[model samples]
Target chain A: MNKQTIGFAGLSHLGIIYSAASAARGFSVVAFDPRTDLTADLAHGRFPVAEPGLDDLYREHSARLTYTSDASRLAHCQLVFVALDVTTNDSNQSDLGPLEKLLAEVTPQLAHGATLVIMSQLPPGYSRKLSAKLADNKLRDNQLFYQVETLVFGNAVDRAVHPERIIIGSDKVGADKVGSDKTGSDKPGEALPAHYAAYLKAFECPTVLMRYESAELCKIAINCFLVSSIATSNTLAEVCERIGADWREIVPALRLDQRIGTKAYLTPGLGIAGGNLERDLVTVQRLAEENGCDASVVTAWQRNSMYRKDWVLGRLFASGLLQNTEQTRIGVWGLAYKQDTHSTKNSPSLALLRALNAYSCQAYDPVAKIDAGQFPHVRVCDAAEEAAQDSDVLLVMTPWREFASAPLERLLPRMRGRKVIDPYGVLAEARCRQLGYQYERLGA
Target chain B: MLQHHRSPHSPLPRTVILGAGGFLSPVLQRNLQAHGATMMALGRSTIDLTKPGASAELAAHIQPDDAVVMAAGLTPDKGKDTATLMANLRMAEAVALALQHSRPAHFLYISSDAVYDARWSSLLNEESACEPSDLYALMHVAREKILGQACQQARIPFAIVRPCAIYGPGDTHNSYGPNRFLRSALNSRTIALFGAGQERRHHVFVDDVAELVRQCIGHASTGVINAVTGHAASFGEVAEMIAALAADNIMIDHLPQSAPVTHRHFDTRALALAFPSLQATELADGLRQSYAALQPASGLAALSSASPASQKPATKKEEAVCP
Candidate 1:
């Protein structure tokens, strides 16, 4: 199949990575953004996000990647990716406004038989609703595909450049629906048209084709399973600490077992903080309640996550680290929920900071910036060493690779006190003990 | 006689048992009886637990000072069908509603070790990932959440007990440890083993489970605990012990090894916290007692008369249910 022009609408995080990756795969890419300033910035190779290696890839393939605010440029492409990170509410509920707005702008300019692939994390059945809306507007069958996006913040370039797998959801029944209108065809050896096959063939990654609901559900199910593992692991880690058994040792043996492999997301930490797992749980709960399915299982997942999220605060209070020290200065390293992303949305570290009674607190992130007014007492430092300077206690909230690999000997000298709470156990316990630092870590 | 510790102001504590006719019910009943405590035992036949009014009716039946033990639910079977999952979930909802309505002093849920996906390790303690493979384990996990929420909302003390491979002489479900061996040895039959029989299992006698539950009832321990033997034994060790205790002519057969089944054989230190003085029967001695108990007049004659072919060696399917 011959490659066709692929358009990317709303050049946000998802759009830039996907468009760049597509362009790198030799597809002529037309990237669109409604904001004139953003498009102008992109044209001069100014990327909005601080993703590692993304800017270099953008620079290398900027020739094949066309950045524009014009909707007419999309008409030249046969396939379009409506890529935008859906905005989440305070309750972790997603607002589909950005997605709907982009769809309204792009659908009108789409050429006949042009496939619209939605590359965003959405609620279960959201894709089916989009498919129905497209069908109601008289779009051809299989013209709309809901493809799942698996991009992580720090590793966006690698995830996009080499994804684990590509999943495509289209309503096309067989090969006959590819390029031509064969509504009444009864032939056995017919092939889908090149135009339709080209949309699927454009992806160099292995594609999983399923129905709309299944594809939408696939994302939620995976997240739910992952969250369940996290919650269970956290629960066990707490038990392990109380029983004086190292959960770290237990987790490896569990991982080696084929039924519970190492990749089951069973790592114990300060619970789930990022938006992906939380959004999926809430989505499943909402949809289950709406459809009258037994949602109690998902609700448990949510409750467990909430309980585990407060684990750091619970540990700090229980350990007496925050007691008798009203004016204690606590240094926290890594503000993002997990390593490698600048996003602090529903971050567990920030939540822990909010619950701390200490009057003076310092925080540092590799890429994330804290709003001055949001955290009145938190002083945002430039680096990890600066954050630990003159601090009564050090709390390693996020397990960013830099902080994990930082020389503890150099950083520990700056702090006044010896208490270091590393939720991820970034520093070796034996080494920390040798340095005479009072160290506490999760699942130790 | 055991000394009783009572609160000065409160009245005598009462307790209610759901699924009172189960394998652990008799021991629980005897323990409660020994304490001279007021208690009520309800079986599924007495109340259709899946119905909407079941909880309300049960709450109305029990007094205010009473606690509720939700031990009633579908056990894992060969089919591991959807109906079993739905039934267990309904049972949980009913128990949660009852606890919510009655505002019990304590809500004790008897969960299973099967909730932990066996793939992780053999000696899973209280803290382990709940990776349930079949619907049975899934249902138990789901129930743990439903009841946990109800207890939280009602401000009642809640305790979840996840027992590992419970076995003893009274287990009519010949699938449990002692009964399976006794039945196989008495009939001079070969015991079909899954895997290399090297996968270890931490088996808790039924009486120990009863003691743990009684301790939780009396002490109001409000978290999850693993009710299991501290020691783990492989199937081969168990079979050899049982064979030696038999009529001396019984043959032990090894079946072709299949893929290992992942299960949580617990480390019961948390349980020991509540019942520090509780004694567990040694595996060999327990097998001997089980063999002796299976004598002709001990009422296991019917089981013994049933051929080994009828017994089917208690496959992994039977393992889902308690031994």
Candidate 2:
């Protein structure tokens, strides 16, 4: 650990969390970003985003960690990771321009023999193209590794530090690569160099080594599977609601079936909304279209997500809750995509607000990075109580804990109407109905 | 008597393998054996593919429920000369003649990526052209036609798997691409590439190809499906990767090209469509495993004596290790 220097070129979601985790694991971590403000803030352990336990990790590992805006700091590192979180546009299309530009800048500062790993979640074949662009350089293919980033937005810290398993996209370079390294042809001792071995040794977890494309696709495959599971749950959960069967009740059956397992994404909610899944779906669609192949399944997931996002709106209209919307004052409980994360890239709450822009709405988010002002008229309230006050119907979009403790029982008698729209089933439906408030939820 | 087990839940399909001593043969046998599925793997020693009515024994060997995996064929290196073309044709005819009598539930043909024209197009899939670039490809194409018809007439579901450059541990075929690239990375530490090494080609791990063939045993998927990962990497990309894995001290030497660069990429939509649950092993993992497995002195001997290399080399010895 003392011999190896782990360097990160981008200090965003992937960079900061990983560097801090690497530092905590007893390795010297040097994190860099082009933005001076971000780097300066990171140096003081002030992360911009709210990831659970991230700040604590940074504070604990700050002594061994160095935050820099200069790329040259990477020149001395034995293993340098290009960990930029690739941004996506409105249509969920990935804009890799920033990641490519960062790689171009990081390449020149790369120390001779330094193993450069692309730790970002880029599209399949992007790494091959990135490696191809550096063909003129003295870089070796084995050094150009792509470790698939499977960090969840809300739980980046724990997921970054202690991953379930590490999947590294790598290749064997040079002449001796054709056959197995153990084929009685070469010396038996550690054939892998000390520097490279040090990098692998630091992982401290079961690691899957794959080629660049497979590594890249594995990320999408995993996300796509999650999306499929979510879609299946949501689609069937909707059916369960109509047929008088609870999805939560059916979950145990699915979980007990060893094939689906207990950890399957069987929870029913307002479809898949995270940008990563959507971005990968778009990528698959684009890949299929370019190749003149069928991507109907991916397109179906996208369609299902869009349809499920409107579930709240659909229920409102079905229950005659949206009648006289010009005078209806709606209260939105949460706005951030999911719990404990400030990212609202494809938050269903924000989508509901946009759909309800025709009506008067009071929105309150416990930790909102999304500006509710985009809805062109919803009033952003200070607290959960204010949003719930004097509302015709209260819509619980995101399941923030603060909303659950928002004194809903006390505020129920004060509202103009008693309709409480909770898509996530955050509050007890029987208690709300017994308190003289009309209760609603998804999939019963 | 065959080697396999019987399970009440999901019975391992009784299987018959045609080319048991081919490149993908050993891995296929190992995987099937691990599943405890009954199988009969026939090689040249068990049955000569060149002889007339060589397939007559297939009827008696095959059971009604048995699936056959045809992995037997001469590779480009072995069949590069014109003298080997007749033997290749004779081998295909023998397999077809054998399948005529006894119809198995499934028949899988281990085809080649060389059947697609690299000059005319780069992106090859199940729908690509049938023009073969060399005699080895021509033989595979011809074999597919003959065997495909035989399966079709027998009302049997057959799969044609055309795998691109296959590289793995115990691989004897030391081609210039991944095979040669790996050898160059280890033996020389300085990888030499043809020209700028810009030619994009597909290289699937031998185990991955075996897994694809295994998928066909129980599956009813028919027609031509290229067993590609849709990850076509450049020769230079491969060189750079090896150079890095070997060490930072390694060098990449770009040499002049003697042959025209043929860019071969594949759209693996068919493979995806056929086997939705298959987790294909990635390239880096395969390379690392292969490298690690083949690291010790004479590491190739680690294979159980049942491996194809034990009886006959998977690929002819590469007299010239690298260019």
Candidate 3:
């Protein structure tokens, strides 16, 4: 019996969770990164980041997993994954230079006939460009693959282990048939080798095998659809706010339809908040300009997101809460992009804070890293109640569990003002109104 | 919880309709929709009711407080064939079994006026004796009994609607009296009548039938109702009304009849008693409306006013009935 060793390159957010999940599924896994400190932290059983249940899984499967900074340690692996999360600059531009530099350094030391799978999210033609470089070096053409990474920030560990489906961008036909859309590509250098095929079976999920460009484009297509829906909901939600109708009551009818199921992304929110969806939109527009495909819908989504980012400021202005800026005290409950974890890339609450740079603001996030250097006058409170203390108005920006479960009957008396503007609708509006706090939400 | 998810704001129920691609089926769907009802119309293309286990598949589509209209059936003029009879029987059984399994909030079966005995010349009402005259009538008569028994046992609130001869837009049957007369007036500028235009029968507008169905479903009714205009007209009067609404140059060709002249009249007193708000459309008004709705984009009523080929009248089977 031959034991297939799986290797992951770059121990970032995408790399750490997937490596730990593969080890938990009874596969011998090896992950390597050139950063010695990050590798040392993982080798000593300290997680490089925070994800729910990630540390426990790593402890249970630590005997089968290896962490190293040496590229030669990946030579014995049949499938070596380059699973780096591409970072964005301060201008929100996708910086692919780091991923390209890492891929160049990791592909050369691989053993003969070992699959070099690029698991990082790539633009449409990036997969083809990298595969062309691998073929130029007399490497076996069948060993190149680009697998799409579908990791949402908060649910990384669970999605890594129990994926809805796996998309392998190679022309390999496995023992079990892949998804219905998997047809053989007419292009060359798209087939997967026997070793990579057997190694991917450890995920125990339905696999989709297609060409490199198709796989790369499929990931963008899914995100574009999701962003369009979110943008549409926000657009209509603004109309509902002006009119007397409630978007929350109307959305359930749409969700019950078979075309849009109960799990549809129909919530009216502060627009597309994370880096992944925005990056995909930018990538789509770039590709569309080169290919001349119609991309007006993507432009509309980006414009709507920018328009929704100023919702908090608009509400405060309309309520006359920010009129006396020198005396008015504002409390912001959460600063993370969403409810969990410490990632703040393209966080809407941070955008609101930046817009309110002239006003005195107090904010709190239980776990998210706050850069005090960005705003000099704003105070970072340790507790959520401290932020809400002596406030003319309180803004519930993020929907953390503590914000929803807090005893508002006991806490509202501490605030100086009797107004709460909650966009998330996490708090009960009726009870808040009964408690004599004037509440304002997006829709009804 | 199911009601919470069905329709949040609309007090009207979500309705599921079978055999919903036909002419009357779509009009009924539109009529109910305008009243704020959420509906799903399934045709044979969606689920072949004759197929085995299709009943179970249909049962899964129903929800609490949802209305189900079984419009699935075959008309006699589509002809006296065993396939037509058997298909209608199977659809009746499948729909009944589905109702027994799901027990929809309201069950409505689109029965026909053909269930009345043709032997009696007097106007037939809901309480009239049902005597199947042929294989086609026999099919509806058997279906009525099966559905009546199945709905009773299943504890489903069921209503049956027996509509008379219907004429309106999208009448593919192009039946003889009003549909063919309008088509003839448009295509050839001529109205072809059978045997001195003397057959006396009841004609109901397609929209009226749809309105009756909508009202029945809304009332959550459990009884039989007839869809008809209390006033019956001779074929000659219907042709004159079409000719008058059409053009000055339209001609009427009185052709020799092959069969005996039949009089089928309906007493719609029960329809008025069931719903006092119901208004039966007049013959001249219904004929004019049907004529205005049927003129094609080719200007058949305007330019092709004298074409002789348009004079050939459509068969009576093309005369209107819904399956």
Candidate 4:
């Protein structure tokens, strides 16, 4: 067994996964969260997040993991990670209050030589500000590092266990500012604590070392690239609808090109939904506004995302199905932002539902629980077909696999109307069209 | 033939390959060899996977640190019956059973895009649901599951490559895409299609699939990837592409439409993310290379004379099928 004892403070999605993965990697881990109930549940193999292989990973390595709510429990560790999932507000601005409080509580209790790595989504200068504040507590500047956490919501366990690359932003005592024009090689990771370096080496991937600001901004940079791809796909998909072309047909040609590569965000969907990407875009726009830099592209992406979010609404208006509010009984399937996630923050389904609130709406989601009081106009159904029953129109909002594989014959008999507006193409258009229903999908 | 050969990179460990006589194996073996891999290419003549006790024989061949490629199976052209399905499952069973005994560093299983539920006409990725349409597709799905479970039990790094309508020279199956188009164009100076050939399907060059396998072996990449060009072309378009390189007087015929014109598209983000350096062969360029490979020393004359295989009449099932 590895002698290193790692500590994770702030046990949210990132902390739970990384701490479990650390324990699986043979390091004894102390998972500390402020919520006592969460820690108590985690001790019994009950994870708040529903990730595949998470329950089993925690169970298999239960002997090596310790779940605690006490901040003082972190003092016994050689390396500590501030693994809080940043909370964002309506404007996509991060509320760093929880992260700030946790750091304040955990910093004074950290072992003298222990390396404190911030593994949260941070703004460009947050790490440097933290380093400056912690200097008063006698925490050595070289001992502070910021590691980018690239864990997706649904696929966190696997990514946490086997990262593609480990990007660490070490504190270069008096390095250049956030956006320096100077060019130089990245700093070496030799300043990292031996235990911390050894823990990263176990992953067997490349370790990229840079200054605190770059590492802080790296997460945002990656998300911005993804947003750009999504914007590109969404824009072209709309064009495909106008012209006699299929965006799906063009995706392959683009993917084969080396410049575009295979994994480009080529799938057209209801714009940027989840909180993280939106947060990064808003941050970029804010940074540009404050720095007096031009961010026309970012502004365009934001506008495009807002426009695309109402894709289902656009189709509904075009069809004039919602013209007679009393006659039109709309069935909306999928409330989550995306499939396999319970979060409904900025969900396009909710956006569509809100637009149709004047009309009677029935909605169903496999996992996401809808508060009955939040939308008095909508009825929450137990099953997908239940939501479709007796409705004049059915809108398959989220492309859940269950929604895709649901038998079309079942929906054919239950629905009162023949119009099916599926933005994500969850159901087969050919099948729907053959069944005497007017089926419409994105990108022609 | 215009080709871009992969340069020598870091040499790979010993690789044990099944299905040596298949069209893709030889090309894959060559590519792996170019990358300095010591290959033990096993064919049915050496170890028939459908026979009993095949697992024991395979187990004895595998060693620690060797990358094993299980590409042996009955193609749809061979037979799409339950008998063929069972035989394919048996092949996978043999490989799975062998892996349980002798663990390799990495295990790769060759699957097909047929495993994906084709009813949903959206872009498919690795995460796409595996709802097989037919027994042939189901056979691949079953084999993948069997091998995946076995690899997991043995703690072996496992990957699955599902290629969409692979076509190139030396292809024996001759699925109703580029391969059959090229053969009909050469032998009869005619390219036949079903229903105006409007159903667009993605086709990856056999060499590109081989290159992907080489990279997977080199990097020890684990997870599922679809070996596709991401470019779906209509059968008419593909026929035109092939005929452009063939004789100018070649005739194009559209037969009666038998089935619905369903299109298949792919989201190959996982493929790009896994092998960023991999360059997929363009369909037009790939067809050109395939056409050149089919040419005899005397050029199209030898094939035009109608060999016994070429003399066989095209079956109704053969011309209508699109996979």
Q: Rate the local accuracy (lDDT) of all candidates.
A: 0.73, 0.75, 0.77, 0.81
Alpha-carbon deviation at B309 in model 3, angstroms: 73
Provide fnat values for all models in the order shown. Answer: 0.00, 0.00, 0.00, 0.00
Of models 1 and 3, which has the larger lDDT?
A: 3
Looking at model 1, the pairs that clash are A179-A193, A236-B127, A254-B120, B118-B262, B118-B263, B176-B323
Task: State the weakest 10-residue window (summed lDDT) of model 1 chain B.
Answer: B314-323
Could you list the CA RMSD of all candidates, in the order they appear?
A: 14.7, 28.1, 25.5, 26.0
What would the TM-scores of all predictions be?
0.57, 0.56, 0.56, 0.56
All candidates' chain B TM-scores are 0.85, 0.86, 0.86, 0.90
Please give the lDDT score for candidate 3.
0.77
Model 3 lDDT tens row, A289-401: 98899998888798678767767766665455654647888888888888866777788888877766657889888878687999765799998889989988889888888
lDDT tens digits by residue: candidate 4, A1-444: 788889999888889999999998899999998899999999999877767789789879999999999989899987999999999998889999999999988998888778899998999998888888788667873378899999877778899898888888867533432232122222243455677768887776777777887787888899989999999999899889968888889999999999989988889989898799999998988899999989989987986787688777766654657557567798888998888777788998987776666679999988787777878999999998899999998998888889989999877679999989888888988999989999888887
| 1 or 3, greater by TM-score | 1
Candidate 3 wrongly placed segments (more than 4 Å): A171-191, B1-323
* Model 2 TM-score, 2 decimals: 0.56
Task: Classify candidate 3 by CAPRI docking class.
Answer: incorrect
Clashes of 3: 4
For residues A355-388, what per-residue lDDT tens digits would candidate 2 score against the true structure? 6656788888878855645776788888877888
The top-ranked prediction according to DockQ is: 1
